[model samples]
Target: MFQHLLVPTDGSALSDAAVRTAVTLATAFKARITGLHVMPELHVFTHRIDTLEDTQERYAQLAERHAEQYLAAVARAAQEAAVVCEVISVTHDQPDEAIIRAS
Candidate 1:
């Protein structure tokens, strides 16, 4: 029996589905769930690159906002399902590393 579950979400439709499924499973199994969102690490070189429209600064801002939004959704799903959930986010260029650390 699973006592704890870790659910990582990106706020995409597919990711959302997975989060919901995790919540349902937690509710049924009477387990705890942790939601994680990893924002890409902002590299110094990334700022040097210029976009046709927005600058790297803008992109970084958007990424931060998106991370917050995605993590919020995870919390909402867990709450609606009446499942205990813990949420956290970190900046790591390699999302895999972040996930590993989170777990």
Candidate 2:
């Protein structure tokens, strides 16, 4: 009996499958779903940039956009299943850490 299910996705095919499974389980149990997408922190030091701040900003923006898109898809799936869903997007250097913290 799951009251709240935390589903982490990276927009990959495998992750999408996991989302479907989570949705099915949530729908079956009438549980609330929390969809999470962790944006990987970009390592700008590896690449030469005119300004580290600019590069970091660019990477953050890109990651945020990707996370938004991924979370939106999950939200749509949950909506279609007629399940309550919450979307969360976090940027962290380690995805696992973010997910663990969210859970």
Task: Tell me the TM-score of each prediction against the true structure.
Answer: 0.80, 0.90
- For residues 6-77, write the lDDT of model 2, one tens digit per residue: 999999999999999999999999999999998877765555556888888888888888988899989999
Tell me how far the alpha carbon of residue 80 in candidate 1 is from the true structure, in angstroms, after superposition: 0.8
Off by over 4 Å in 2: 46-49
Q: What is the Cα-based lDDT of residue 52 in candidate 1? A: 24
Error of 2 at 53 (Å): 2.4
- The candidate maximizing TM-score is 2
lDDT of each: 0.84, 0.91
Q: Tens digit of lDDT per residue, candidate 1, span 46-81?
A: 534455236557777888799889988988988988
Candidate 1 C-alpha error for residue 91, in Å: 0.6
